[model samples]
Target: MFEPGRLHLEHSPVQPPDVAYELIITYAPASSQDGPSMHFQVTGHIAGQPVDESFDLAADLAFNFASSIDHLARRHGLPATQVVPISLHRQYDEMFADIQHKLGRHCGDPVDARHLGKT
Candidate 1:
């Protein structure tokens, strides 16, 4: 799980000094067992202009953070790079499963039937 904190972006030659980006995440309970959805709020400055946006991801899709970031980067015309390294695919999968397990425990329910295929 990504800790809720300021994510220090890597220094890349393509990144402009005038642009600063930050991501804030929050979780909220939902009416369905497949919920307790996650919200990602991306805020930043681009060319001295403020930019902000939020995306709500259901629990089933919450593990696809890298893809979400790629889409966000594309929307902003920024470079889209793999957030998870290929070598870490196994670790990422384990971590995602752990998150699902913990969420189930905390929410007092099993994983949703619709998501059984995903696991």
Candidate 2:
């Protein structure tokens, strides 16, 4: 249940200065034992034209994000030397909290085994 946010572009010799990119993450409900999946979409404008690409991942969100950025950059013909490491800040704190709450409700939280050892 992630939402699309602002676009940011890193200035590099291989990448056009006028290009901008945005990454969007969305939740995908599945019956797999690994819990929910995530779909990462990278949309942007290159030379006044819109370019969009997406891929589904079942790994950790943070890892998926970085991989998605790299995938998009490569798909758009951007050179590896021009690729920049994207840093996702804590701006989605509230959104993440909400997602946690929802996931907790949908999928029961992990039991604290340490509590079973107590009297």
Model number with the top lDDT: 1
lDDT of 2 by residue, 49-113 (tens): 46576655442342234545666666666555544345444434533444444334333444334
Clashes of each: 0, 0
Candidate 2 Cα outliers beyond 4 Å, as residue runs:
1-35, 46-49, 59-62, 88-119
List ranges where model 1 is wrong by over 4 Å.
14-34, 45-50, 80-102, 105-119
Q: Write the per-residue lDDT of candidate 1 for residues 43-110, one digit (tens) a residue.
A: 65333345466665566655664566546645665544423231254444544554465345443444
Query: Best-fitting candidate, measured by TM-score?
Result: 1
The ten-residue window of minimal lDDT in model 2 covers 110-119
Q: TM-score of each candidate?
A: 0.48, 0.45
Question: For candidate 1, what is the TM-score?
Answer: 0.48
In the predicted model 1, the residue pairs found to clash are none
